[model samples]
Target: MGTLRDAMGYPVLRAGIILLVLALLISIAGLYRVDKSYSSSGTLGEGMHYLGDDKFENEYLYHNRTLTLSSTNATISLLQGSEMYNYTLVNDSVTLHPEMRPAIYVFNGEVNYTYDARAIDYPYAVYSIGAFVIMLAGIALSFIGYTQFLKDVKGGKK
Candidate 1:
């Protein structure tokens, strides 16, 4: 009969050890804990102007990830087909990105005011969930391997 040392050579145990190590390394990534991030949508004053399509030294305003025309009146002229948003809460304000990318917006209110914009969505908790799955799989493998190791030891004893 082989000694308990021989049972340590079990292939399942080796794989389980590797997985356990990998799970530990992956757990480090979980420490980052990336939460969902987004700027709350807001409204500005009405009577937003149709600033020039090429420049915004005057009426164009962007705040809290929101782009709007700042005016005290609720009137906007859409010369063509375009999207427009207004915020009656604040005036012209500037800030840095909550994320990145400074987009060039062309609010063509000169010939005809046309505003175009889009909404973006980002995944939340995906990385944390992925790491957790790997850890769970590794734990399951380790448990199975430990049971196999016990069986191997008993068989060796016989």
Candidate 2:
């Protein structure tokens, strides 16, 4: 074990370590290349609606007012009928001031319409975690194998 070659004398241990390192690197890159797109949940109204903060802006019109809103306080206000509804900002939730649920049922024939924002791809995270665990296992196995190899060499065994 005095030289690099001597340290890697055990072929099985060396190959396992090398494969583990490659898998670790590939897993990291896969995580980075994973899909980052996510949706925000929100309600749809009759006219223009905005669902974002000062840094970003996502606008929608009457036809596309149904939006997946993020968990951020967006200055939501109807551009056409400002007085028709009252808006309240709450933590991760929004409230209609005048309680338009009844009116919505009468006009649109629906109590409310909301967009569900859920992650479509989650296997990337699972694979990344699995790779990390396997890498650790590989390192532990290599250590044990090297220790046993050294002991055998000292006892005059190959």
Candidate 3:
């Protein structure tokens, strides 16, 4: 125990502890940032749903929509008719009413639609993961340094 304590008291060990603590603190900050960003992105609801279907210029159409809510506001985007006709509502709670247009068969009469309200930046999660990896490396380095110190102490006594 004394040797262990002495080993931990070394400058290198102290530096490793500092590094580990800093890494943990940065990781926690990154997680908080992730939560904040997610909340602000307004995608925290049950996700988008298929509103209904309509017809434009004798062609069948589908409308998929998603709503995102914030503290005092909401946003909605409608994926309807065509990719070039994405309708969005900002800071207002209203259903999408897509205007009728002549449907152009750009994809062999088949079109895929998707609405992603929860799409958010992931730099915070990346930062958190990177920090965690650094923290683990610091722990491993500290353990190896301490083991080397203990071996050195034992060798000196022998």
Model 1 pairs in collision: 43-87, 44-87, 44-88, 45-87, 45-88, 46-73, 47-73, 47-74, 109-113
- lDDT for 57 in candidate 3 is 24
Query: Lowest summed lDDT over 10 consecutive residues: which window, candidate 2?
Result: 101-110
Assess each prediction's global lDDT (C-alpha) against the native: 0.42, 0.45, 0.45
RMSD of 3: 13.9
Q: Write the per-residue lDDT of candidate 3 for residues 52-156, one digit (tens) a residue.
A: 223212232232224322222333334446554332333333322244321212211122332222222334555777788778878877877777677777788
Taking the tens digit of each residue's C-alpha lDDT, what string does model 2 give over 1-158? 24456657777578668868976886976554322222344354444443323221221111212332222333344333334433333335443222111122112111132432222333445577767777877887688768867886787665
TM-score of 3: 0.40
Q: Over all chains combined, what TM-score does candidate 2 have?
A: 0.41
Highest-TM-score candidate: 2
Error in Å for residue 11 of model 3: 2.7
lDDT of 2: 0.45
TM-score of each: 0.36, 0.41, 0.40
Off by over 4 Å in 1: 1-8, 33-125
The digit string of per-residue lDDT tens for model 1 on 104-150 reads 23232211212332232223334656667766776777678678777
Off by over 4 Å in 3: 1-4, 34-123, 156-158
The total of clashing pairs for model 2 equals 5
